[model samples]
Target chain A: MTSHPDVEALAFFAEELLEPDEERTVAHHIETCALCAATLDELTAVSGVLADVPPVPPMPQDVADLLDRRIDEAVRERAGSDDTATETGGPVAPVVPFTRPKKRGFNGMNLPRLMMLAAAGAVVVGGGGAVLNAVMSTQQESAVGGSAAPLLQEEQAEEAVPDAAQPYKPEIVGSGTDYTSKDLADQAADVLDATVPESGYGAEEEAQDGSILIEECAVSLGERLGVRFTLVDDARFEGAPAWVLFAPMGDTTEVYVVDPAGCESPDGVLEQETFTTR
Target chain B: MDAVQELPDRELLTRHTQGDDQAFAVLVRRHRDRLWAVAVRMMGDREEASDALQDAFLSAFRSADRFRGESQVTTWLHRIVVNACHDRLRRRKARPSTPTEDDTLDVLSNDRLGRVGGGPDHASQTEARLDVHAALETLPLDQRMALTLVDMLGYRVEEAAQILDVATGTVKSRCARGRAKLLPSLAHLRNPHPPRDVTTGRGGANPS
Candidate 1:
């Protein structure tokens, strides 16, 4: 209070965090003190600069798409398993609590895998240095459905993936970084959009209003990734319904072939692949 | 459900918990950007921010029902993101980077050439900001988080207290101490007042 309001006092003064009398004392002293005044001005400017740091721009589009897909998968995985009772005419749980499930893989979205996929996602998504030295990603590199040897029969896996799934190599939009669940959904939507024209939906000119379809798919993809295939409309691809699927790898999102009459786990048809149906 | 996107975040959250699947995504979309800003600055690395963001959102989705309506969803989300970033930072021990090889001049040049005005003064401002950012990393984690929430992110001290789960006095003291350390780091950015000009022993203008 006496020995010329030190740096803390100057900062508290700048921040208005001092007692009223202390504030007055600092103000009066600063009025006569150039050094403290300059110091306060500097502190104020530092705060200004920190505030000026720009907001990271919404995880970019690709990342958002990826995030959506992941969330969808998690939602469906939970719903798919938890709702089995309802599916079998058993009593439904009265409450749907948003509690964190046991530390088990919520359809393969365990913490370690989520962390691993995020690292792989950042790299494949392309941005930021090899974050964490791709540390987590490399640990589970094979399980990610990225750079993994096919776990299923090569023929059936190839059959499931099909060359059609290869035609439209995803442009993985925006700066490659931060693949959120929504971002994954958007990536799936991209596949859906690209698949429409290929499914004989129409020509480029006819289906130009594909915006509605893409929008529908984007929203629907989020809720139905691992849940029951909600046969989004009667749209068929390669004589089968195109379904939104969450690959076991926990990151890939694709519109894959679904047989409604024989609804089955997608893991059977495809093992660790990101591809489109038909 | 067209209004789903337009509903208050609380309502959206309610709908989400009540089984409106798209509701959670809407909430995430609504708040993700600002939360991204928090995560990026706190995590101090782009990838770390991304990872933390993913965990935060997933946690938010799982924990939405736990929100007892005590605070704005934004505050709730910010806390989650901060906690996520803190976890990553702890795991990585990624120190706030020093000026190892990235010179201030290099940072200046990296700015859009035409954007930052050509002058030593503009360069100084750029360097000062970078320095402040680097300096921020040097603080202890608690001080860093407190300073970040109050100063950098513009959260109210009370709200920061809630987010950090600390007393307001604690936030105030942290800011005070953090600012005290920061001032010296930022002294060059302050008006360069000619080194006191008191070597004349005349005590400059103020003879006191």
Candidate 2:
């Protein structure tokens, strides 16, 4: 089969078509076809330059301020009309409420209306008596079946008690020499286990022991293909405050923490950080 | 509610429908800058753009009930601005075309990329920028609007189509054609050498 020039196919690829298989096919074609390859390269270069264009400057302050006042006046006028309608106990000028009851002298009662009234009357009488009868029967049944019911209930209560609690005993496990900070770090790590990089947390640095101190630490997701979760506050966990930041790399997320020493260093504190995709 | 506090666009629309003046103000405050940008880019004249922006917003407020929220608030407002710009363009075309000296100078000086005799000023770069502006102005109104929305303003093709009331396919075709035509105008900035010919399966060859 003969294939056409496929300008659209080339354009799609040049635009980052965002599909892996299509991208791979386009890559193959560019490698084999010199003309397509050159065109693709030129288009990509121009697009990169275009992406650097700055945003349009904001509107003038005076114009914006004037519009702001006008809008306020319009909204207030509307609110005032609504208030007047409420006070007068009548419909607003153009917007008449649809709830005004219709005049009744027109025709004989319709079948649908008669049927609805009859159904309501029947429900009032039949429903009230049946409910009373059901309540009486249930009470009588419970009274006559008392002993058997109590035994069943007792068995159910026994079964509800967890087997694990039967021989419960308090056990103290030692996380030898690990302090509150270490415990918090471990907790933070566990919370972000799927996101943090394996090489990110230094293994040699042990967490210090003290009362959990709420320190402002930045928490971020590691490099992965997922949502970027930026934690705004240095959250206090069990007492230690840790900064959390999140970034998506490819298929996984990575989380990182700024060490306390680095946090105190007078670089005026780096408020923003960058993440690399793996 | 405190009338001065900022309300979201949807809330403002609701209040406007109920005849709330302050709510309308909040809506205008929220959208004025973005709407002004759209109008200015479309009309290429700041004064005309400002008028279009105000007129569009006023019309939108006047017909608040007609806005059914089928699309985004910004998208709906954009439709109004686009229509207003079209109306302005039609009116301008009907009148005599007079190129004032200041208009010519403004067109010339805009080539500096807003940097007047400050940093690295290259003649070719300046000429290329002016050529691009002129070429963009040369395109049909629809194609130009599509290009500005998709390429310059960073709107998604689907969103642009919605705002322009055209099919997505139409938007894609217009954008592709518009960008291709405008490419030659920036030839000074692009590579000077042309690409080699490549064979097509249809028993023909074309240059890249």
Candidate 3:
């Protein structure tokens, strides 16, 4: 009480934060000490100063759009397996039974596969020569037993539309330094291993954890190529930054290394490889 | 659809758990603005705030069934949002950032350049907001969050305690320390009278 209390003590006293005895002592001192009293008043006004400033402008439009898209994707993924009996009246996509083509070879083509072949044939006939060129590339790659085919077939059957039954989205797993063809094969095996145990394929993951630019690239690229990539590795290829995209086929995985800058363009694909799951 | 809009938060959450798909979206639409305010204040950057809010809502949606109705749904949402921001800030701090010029300066200049004739009042208001955010960046995260909830956002101490999952006294003490630390910078901003040349010696205690 004899000397003026410090400013922090005054701040504590204002919030009633001091010990009872100390609170009493400060209270008695500030009663007569004009300087300490003025400091206390200034400290008390801090909140008013802060509150008087206008708040940050309402959420930006792009952020709102991103939020809505993320929420919609979540709703669809959950609705696929949502067991509750209540009829959903919202504008959600009708829940489809989760299906993945098991190790059914070309000889075992079923109804969905036949439908898929019809769809691919239709694409070749109606969609123009560019799509046919893309499909023919897949056909040639499929000719290599170690390369792509069943994925193009499955992508036609499953995600014929960009929004259909996307239980898995591209998620970044790790940096892609020193990734050999062997490493790509090993990663493909891991992706297939992760898919077998659950229909959701780690659907609970924070799938959009990558930067917005990377996510948009993956999505746009998926739309262009007509396949949803399940795993994306931020990669370095030929001493340049690249992205490695993985989509699990029947028993093999299709891997593409693309330049992140021009990800939506066909020229962006720096390399393509496929390896059968062991 | 009109009826869906009229349902209360708890009813919406209950319906969401029971498989009504629209209920959660309606709940989000009703509360996103207020939650956005809390998040923007917690994280000074808009993009980071957006990311945090999305993470929180998705988490809330998934865990709606486990919410035993112990607290108001709004409080629960706020807790998730604050925790999300906390985790991001911790991870951001763990990795040292590359050196760059102050982003707040860029923001202040951009505001001035973008607005043509917003009037002096409008311009100064933006400056004040940026200044406050810059000052807030100096406090420890725990104290920053406490003061943000109690002082800037005007939540009650008890409410802040609930959101922060800390004791009432703990919230009060954190706010006290934060206020003390902020006083020197804020006083310079608020008081038009030029600061005296004489350093009160106590002024040296200012963390910034």
Candidate 4:
């Protein structure tokens, strides 16, 4: 009845997802309308192009091995639970891999990725780690080092994995270690806009001032969010309260608004505490 | 692991459910290629996809009892993987950035992409492939999954509906909308009487 069958109809026509009568109707419409016919062609082209994408290479063997170990552990635990159930007739609970993983502001980093980061930290500069270090180093200094330590650590690791001999907790996002540039950086999808707390740190004396500890902490956090702290340019922007540090990763710049109050509180800046980076 | 490598995915999954962890490894090996393809395409980042794949396999291992056997084992695995990818996508707040043509957009996937600049032939092909991927990233998850299953991965609409646990009409609409979006996003790839109609596998592909 109608001259146009719409995109769904064209898609159905391309995939033969239509009824025989519907198919004929769409085909007949295509024959009469150049736009419908052309639309069908474009949809067909998209399908063709998508189909051409090469399959991703197989997962790295080491990661596969790690997964195998975890699964094996789960199966073994389940077997143990089954044994316990048979002996005591108690209901067996499923083995949760993580304990309380859903914490606020904690990036749900996979265990293998954490392992990779640990491995990268211990030896070779992993591509991911380098990227992570460059970006996360500064952010960690600021995000967690401030009065937010209790909030950050509130979501502490329950069962810390013994990563490479060190009893490392995967949940501890801001590893204080100075990370080199990037093999293992977390890809930050959207960096939150700066919501700098109003304070009395805008005085000229506070400009170009911040501690090395503050810079390191910021780097630690920023690496997790893909922002590498390159250098600290003084708080030059108009009406800026704290010393501003610009952390440039690839093309985007993460403006770290340093609280002169040494990351104390919303009330004030802590002396001449500015921020710098590696 | 090598002995069970040839076993069908269903058999391997069943054995894994029966507490034979090694059987799962065989299944993993068998489907790694296709699994990687689905995850990489869905998640757009190899690292993110890798994490999602691990999570999916683990979830499958843990919840093997829930699979009702209404669909193919591959489809079930894909469904779980797609859901996990969606979780990561939701967690990763940024809209995925489209990579430049020459950018090694998939460096972490392996060494093959490292050698991608194999003259104009490979260069253009890789660029076109990346373009489609970027376009796919822009679509809504439901629409993207529908197109991915029905069009990209060569599943029928009914089969995709089964995999996604949605009505067939939903899958059709989603695929259609997805295709609609891709048409303009990939306008550069389209041409009059395009010479390449034969993709080896998947929808509307000319039989070779």
Candidate 5:
């Protein structure tokens, strides 16, 4: 029987065979051919001996210490620059936007402005809740069973639209007491109770509004995660102003910034914090 | 700072982008040891390695905002260190060093292969270690790096290729060639054969 010189082929494929997917092919070929199998054995043995070699001694301790010091200094310099930017309320150096193709519709909208609006929404929702409650409480007593009931129902109907679409919700908070205080609280509850379907965020205008809602959602999420969100820096990304969202996690903190370029992936966002474990 | 310390790499980087020095320090401390090893091995001298390591780390820190986390932190740092080491080597080579034949031979002797044996054989183990060191020094820089990363340091070939910025095939070929060269040198330690003419061609003559 004339057997093929499979050993040379195996030698050629030894490295490829190291990958798990190629093992079956390698094993089948080796089983039918003794020469290739022996070659594999030799390669394996050689690799084993080489593995026994010790690593070069670690870089000297003093050198490592110096590297640590230099890194610390660089980090400190960056922190100092950030602090200065925060103090002056000046634009901070932009984090490099993700080097990916820009997403559609991201160009027309201003993300930082939207983020600020979202922040304002949060403050309005949280701080205005009690005032809204007082207004609704008084209305509940006065309008127990008359034409005021229809007005309250109509107001609730207006708020039933998703938060992104309900421009009237913020207007209610802004134009405080324009409606009877009781009606405003009922309207706020109506806004909170309405569900914002993911599908509603499709049109460019809607998407921009959706982005604001998403930012609000992120803020709420951060709160739930025990992270405090602080706006520490602002810079332009891909021509749009990007806001730095700083969240303190225990003794360590995290920074998340939207990409002005509107990169689609999570990687599109920049995380530029020098964190240490407390 | 303590709050920053408890955050994960992703969170830490976010803080770093916002200009948190403590967050950057955490990243440096996390990566320094392995980066140092890569630098030291590539440069083959402690002083040069230190310089290379510091440059790489500092540059990485300055550019932390640019990091997209497409690859693991270690892989990214390794690429930086390797690039720095290559630059240093190029500069070192631009200024030549002349050594006496006796010194050259002494260095070669130090490169001898060490035996792999155990028991109360401290003397033998020490001799074997010396041999391994000598063998490592004899390899070309590329092969030496491949061997160091793949065999000794336990990096997968793909990871090593990323760090070395080479195709996987190139890493594999270098690793194979490196082992082949080291094998003969190691075998010769046991048999004491006269040195054969070493050729530079690939697969041309693997002295058995």
Candidate 6:
């Protein structure tokens, strides 16, 4: 009761959020302490100020028009599915088009995006022909075919990845192999699509787990770039040893090529490009 | 359709679930204005708000049968809208496209200009809104949503709790934390003439 509580405590006091004993203590202290009392008043004034600010103007016509259109789409899609189900008299074909690109050979790969793929926990690749059970929640949710479903599906899709397994072993396509900037997009997608079988590389794989250094570097770059890269190519770009990072953003994937030694540094990203994904 | 306009919210939801197509649109028209206000405050951007609102309403439309009747239809709608905004905000956080700290301050300064120019009341009001929203952007999503519902939209704490699906105490504590965070940035905004030396003035009194 002798010392003035900090502002957070005073704020909690204003909200009656403090425990009874602490509340009594602060209440008694603020009763005599002018500064604490004034601080508490300011906190209350903050809410009052927020309350007094005017409400948003009416919903714009454009937004209303968009909403109506989206709803109409949803209704029609629903009606179509229902009609198809009644006519077929069996399981209805899924209306959601899982827009995955064709299964290209996931050969030749690298490292930065591997960290993110492991991070997203979605693609649990066991081996070649490994049924890469990507949780694919976004596409599946869109399977429900609600018109607004796709707008916020990525968040849920990102969360669907499991955190436990070390099953992801990225194929490091020939370190120091030179890649032309022209073919980098195709090369990046190849790495992104590469998956190794779950078997082999027992203790050696555990040792590679020490690539926590590379993982941390990728994480730092991801934070700086505001992208969780799903694949990284530890290959050479033009001539120098480089790390190519791939991050998917809806219909497009961004590729960042960085110096291996300086990928963690601010000037690490030597080249960056965007390509439309199929 | 005219009669559907008079239906209560729950009645419309019931009818929609029972395959009355017009009922849902009527329900949307009835509450879209208030829901828009919530979304705009939560999002701090009109386009994102519009997207979130559309996402929420369509999700509601598709899932009407899942309505358990434990809460009011409006409460249910608010929950969906808040959740939709939350998801988009989380993803946007991962993208570097959000305005940076310098941009927010630039917005605040320009808002001050609009006020000092002695423009029409409508313009000043709009600037005040911009100032408020800019300050709000700095807060964590949970705190921002709580403050938006309880303080900005003036929902009751218990009502906000229902919409947020949290305890009433949780809402109050979140509002309290948000207010504490907002105080330093916003106190000067309340004063007509902001002190030039912010470091030495009341604006500098950061309690945290």
TM-score on alpha carbons, each prediction: 0.53, 0.46, 0.57, 0.50, 0.45, 0.61
Alpha-carbon lDDT, every model: 0.50, 0.45, 0.61, 0.50, 0.47, 0.63
Highest TM-score, which number?
A: 6
Q: Write the per-residue lDDT of candidate 2 for residues B68-145, one digit (tens) a residue.
A: 888887788888888778655544443425353246446555644465543435654554444444556656667778
Candidate whose lDDT is highest = 6
Among these predictions, the greatest DockQ belongs to: 6
lDDT of 1 by residue, A127-152 (tens): 11111112113223423442222222
For model 2, the DockQ equals 0.08
By summed lDDT, the worst window of 10 consecutive residues in model 3 chain B runs over B198-207
- Candidate 4 lDDT tens digits, B1-208: 3677777878778887777758877776677667777777777666556667765776666566555677888878777777777655643433234342114444312323454543447656665665566567667778888888777777788888876778898898788778866666554355544324322222121111
Task: Write one digit per residue (lDDT tens) for candidate 5, span B106-146.
Answer: 54344323323433265554544444544666667778788
> What's the CA error at residue A169 for candidate 4, in Å?
22
- Model 4: per-residue Cα lDDT over A1-278, one tens digit each: 46688776787687677889999988888888887887788787887777766656776675566556545555554564444433432222121112322211134334333222322222111112222332343235324353223222312210121111110001112112222123112111111111111111111122112333444334432322223343332232224334433444223334444454444332222122112222
Please list the residue runs of candidate 4 whose C-alpha ends up more than 4 Å from where it truly belongs after superposition. Answer: A1-9, A12-29, A76-278, B1-11, B93-120, B192-208
Instruction: Please state the CAPRI-style docking class of candidate 5.
Output: incorrect
User: Which tens-of-lDDT digit does each residue in B84-115 have in candidate 1?
Assistant: 77654543343223242244335534552544
Q: Lowest summed-lDDT stretch of 10 residues in model 1 chain A?
A: A164-173
Interface root-mean-square deviation (Å) of every model? 8.7, 17.3, 9.0, 8.0, 14.0, 7.2
Q: At residue A58, give the lDDT of candidate 6.
A: 83
Residue range A1-278, candidate 2, lDDT tens digits = 14323655665565554269877877876787877776666554344333333466898875575455434433433444334523532221121111211211113433223222222211110111112222223323423453223233323322331111100111101111112334533433333332211111111112222101111222111111111232212333234443443322222333333333354332323232222223
Q: After superposing candidate 2 on the true structure, give the runs of residues whose Cα lies further than 4 Å from its correct spot.
A: A1-33, A45-50, A65-278, B2-6, B90-106, B109-129, B190-208
Q: How far is candidate 2 from the true structure (C-alpha RMSD, Å)?
A: 28.4
The residue-by-residue lDDT of candidate 3 on B1-208, one tens digit each, is: 4699998899999998887878888888888888899988887777668767876786677667767798899988888788777755543444425121146556656764666655557676776576667667678889889989999999999999998878999999898888887777676556554236312532322223
Q: What is the TM-score of chain A alone in each candidate?
A: 0.32, 0.27, 0.36, 0.30, 0.26, 0.41
Q: Is candidate 4 or candidate 5 better by lDDT?
A: 4
- Residue-level error in angstroms, candidate 2, position B198: 22
